[model samples]
Target: MKTKFLLDPNITFLNHGSFGAVPREVFAVYQQWQRTLENQPVRLLGRKLPSELRAVKSALGSVLNANPENLLLISNVTFGLNLAARSLNLQSGDEILTTTHEYGACLNTLKYLAHKSGARLVQQPVSMPLKSPEDVIEEIWSGVSPKTRLLFLSHITSPTASRFPVAQLCRRANRAGILSIIDGAHAPGQLEIDLAEINADIYMGNCHKWMLSPRGAGFLYAGSAVQAILEPLVVSWGWNVDTPATPEMGLLENLQWTGTYDPSAFLSIPAAIDFQRKHNWINVHMSAQETLSRFLHRFSESFNIPIAYTPEADPYIQMAVLLLPPIKDPEKFQNQLWCKYAIEIPCIEWQEHQFLRVSYQVYNTEADLDRLFSAIEDLMPSFLTTSSHTKSGSL
Candidate 1:
């Protein structure tokens, strides 16, 4: 798997949740698409791109168990979220309900929407040591009110690495007449995605994160019922400004052609799907979590840190955020792992606590985890000393 990917072999990459690494085969297709686009710009962009992209969408639809007509190619999830936020046309006193465990960029997007429309953004806390899906559902549902116009949540939260019971919540939102949007940025390739099953009004996912596609590959899925209300972020061929909007125009006509950039990333999606299938990635994904679970136990005992919870839950399938002892400077500790040890993993400060969010991809080997553990052991003393001095108010 390591040889299959194009990541720097010198660095131990434990963070695939942040921009994903592209497989060599998929990258070859990406490069080929770029060359093809450059080879005959007019022929491809003007005539061939739409059909070719439709083929890609059809392929993606198969993977997601969705209709190609419902999906639109996007640069990333952030773009889709911003589009959803602004298009909904929230008014004064409207509330956008979400949990505190959501991604930061999405929180900002909702914040902007709230400020612009005089709406409210209620971040209900889901609390630590998550117990059960039913409990989590009731906890988040408490935030919904009469004025709750839209319900936005992550299918998988970025910071906490939690797989929310989105289907249950989306069903609740649907019954309540609240529009539901899911940011599934870290879902594809890592977990099974069935857009129909999730049943959200709008759903967005990034293929670049876990799907092994080239960076900048993502898709936005809007249910047929809600597609009518969506306003494209950029007005292009999508907008029939002078002419009346046509019923035949779906996501393809409304949001697909927003001034051409590079379609290579989007085009490479089929190849990425092929790569995972050829490698039997479902078993691989499951195996990764099993290995990480075993490693976490050892890591917890060796470091004398209490286990927060078992990552056997869907929320922690291939990725898990492990608890770490309080550090005076989490940034410096993270830098030491990167600058000194050449280990690429995220050390996060969330909710006044420090953490190590490890992403176990197919490329991560036993040696890579060993390298990370060794480096942490070497630097643990210094980190603890810094915490002691900082707490004592002495340098």
Candidate 2:
């Protein structure tokens, strides 16, 4: 599996959550699109690209259970949320509710919009060691009030790697007349997603992260009910709003084309989707879970650092955040792992605490995680103040 990707074999890359490794076949397809576009730019971009994009959307739509007409191929989740946040006409005293675990960029988008509209962006803190998904639903919904006009949240939180109960939350938001916009950056390839079942007003996800595609491959989905409310980020040729002179042009016309831009990545959606289908991602997901579960158990047993996810609720899947023992300098610890161990993972700082995030994809194995465990054990003594860092094993 690792050979099928272009990632360096010298590095133990456990950070697929950051930017996904593209399959060789998908990369070939992406390159092919670029070459084909250059062959006849006008013939393809002006004439055939729209129809080709419709096919890509159709394939992706089937995977997401969303109408192809409702989806638009975008650059990334950040871009998609930006469009959604700015389009919502919030008034003074209106509030957008979210959680502390959301990706910072998405939160910034909401914050900027709220500030512009004289509205409030309420970031509700979710309790750690969650008891159940119901607890999550309650924690976020408790932030809602009559002032809450929208609920913006991550399907799978970036920092913590916890999958929120967005579907249930969306259902709840629907009852209260609050719009739901889900940042599904980590949801599409990691889990089985159904946009219709989730029923969010707007959803944005990246194919580049977990879907085994190149960078700049992402999409935004807006249900027909909220499509009319969206405003394009760039005022290009397709900025036709609902005017008497022109019929209401949907997202296809309004935000699809911005200018002369390279869309090879966007055109590679079908290849990415096909790669997953051909690989039996279901079995791959299960295998990754099994390996991740073992590593989580062994590391917790040896290091005495409790895993972030609640054991029973288990809101997490492959990606995990382990709160590290206090270190003099978090950057040094991370640097040592890369420089000495050749391990590629993220050392995160969230809420005044340092965390080590692990993201194992299909290419990873138990041996890979075992190497991580051994490296941490070998290096822990130098990083820790005391010689011990464990509950019963050592410290």
Say which candidate scores most in lDDT. Answer: 1
TM-score of 1: 0.96
lDDT of 2 by residue, 168-219 (tens): 9999999999999999999889999999999998999999998888999899
Which stretches of model 2 miss by more than 4 angstroms? 241-249, 385-395
| TM-score for all models, in order of appearance | 0.96, 0.95
| Candidate 2: C-alpha lDDT | 0.85
* Clash list (residue pairs), candidate 2: 388-395, 389-395, 390-394, 390-395
Give the candidate number with the greatest TM-score: 1
- Number of backbone collisions per candidate: 1, 4
Give stretches of model 1 more than 4 Å off: 310-314, 385-395
Worst 10 residues of 1 by lDDT: 386-395
Q: How many angstroms is residue 373 displaced in model 2 relative to the true structure, after the best TM-score fit?
A: 1.4
